[model samples]
Target: MSARDWQKSSFSGEGNACLYVSAPDNATIRLRESDEPDTILTTNPTALNALIRNAKAGRLDHLSKG
Candidate 1:
């Protein structure tokens, strides 16, 4: 995808590192960190949605605490 194709998350803080995503096709979604745009993660719509839900619920916040 091109630079204009990726969209930044609205929850990202002002002038801080952020998360960006791009879905050029229905079969896949791409994720990248603003600080390291070269590294991208490819995932499906279903799995990505689940991850977003879990993250918003804090399920992925403290994995080492358990």
Candidate 2:
């Protein structure tokens, strides 16, 4: 599929350091930091949903600190 448009999270407004995502197809989700446009990471919908749920539950904050 063609590269899709990347959009930063609305919660991360006006920042150079933020997560950007391109949802080109339902089967895959692409993600990259705004500072690293050349490198793209892909994940499945199920894994992405789990990560989102973890973030909402504050499980990711522990990883960020260490």
Candidate 3:
């Protein structure tokens, strides 16, 4: 695997919790948090878009409940 150029939102503060995203290729997306750099999550574009859409619509909120 090659090194990915990770990017974070401009609104992200200079803190350890910032989320970073990268495109390893046209078909793959990579995600990582600054506090846990060694752990990365991968998915395809379609799945990622679905996640974002569902998140915005509060469809995934239940998963966060304790």
Candidate 4:
């Protein structure tokens, strides 16, 4: 985790609620927030792509608190 470079989302606004993403290795993607660097969420490429696709299709809009 320390060796790889983490990048922030371009959509992240001028707030502390920033999203960071990186690949820790060849097989896994790591996601974390700017405020909680220690808390990382790891997932495989397949599942991560599925989540992105579902999110883009508005299939997961219902999960929002707003």
* Predicted structure with the largest TM-score when compared to the true one: 3
Ranking, TM-score, top scorer first: 3, 4, 1, 2
| Regions of model 4 farther than 4 Å from truth | none
What is candidate 4's lDDT per residue for 17-60, written digit by digit as tens? 99999986889999999889999998989999999999999999
| Model 2 agreement with the true structure over 1-66: per-residue lDDT tens digits | 234588777777676788888888889899887777788999999999999999999988988885
For model 2 the local lDDT of residue 32 reads 88
| lDDT, model 2, position 59 | 89
lDDT of 1 by residue, 1-66 (tens): 689999998878766489998999999899999889999999999998898899989998898577
lDDT of 3 by residue, 1-66 (tens): 334588886767997878988996899999888898889999999999999999999999999999
Higher-ranked by TM-score: 1 or 3:
3
**Candidate 4: how many backbone clashes?**
0
Error of 1 at 34 (Å): 0.8
Q: What's the lDDT of the predicted structure labeled candidate 3?
A: 0.87
Error of 2 at 29 (Å): 0.3
Output the better candidate (1/4) by TM-score: 4
lDDT of 4: 0.88
Model 4 Cα displacement at 14 (Å)? Answer: 3.2
What TM-score does candidate 1 get on C-alpha atoms?
Answer: 0.78
Query: What residue pairs clash in candidate 3, if any at all?
Result: none
Give the lDDT of residue 36 in candidate 1.
91
lDDT: the better of candidates 1 and 2: 1
* Each candidate's clash count: 0, 0, 0, 0
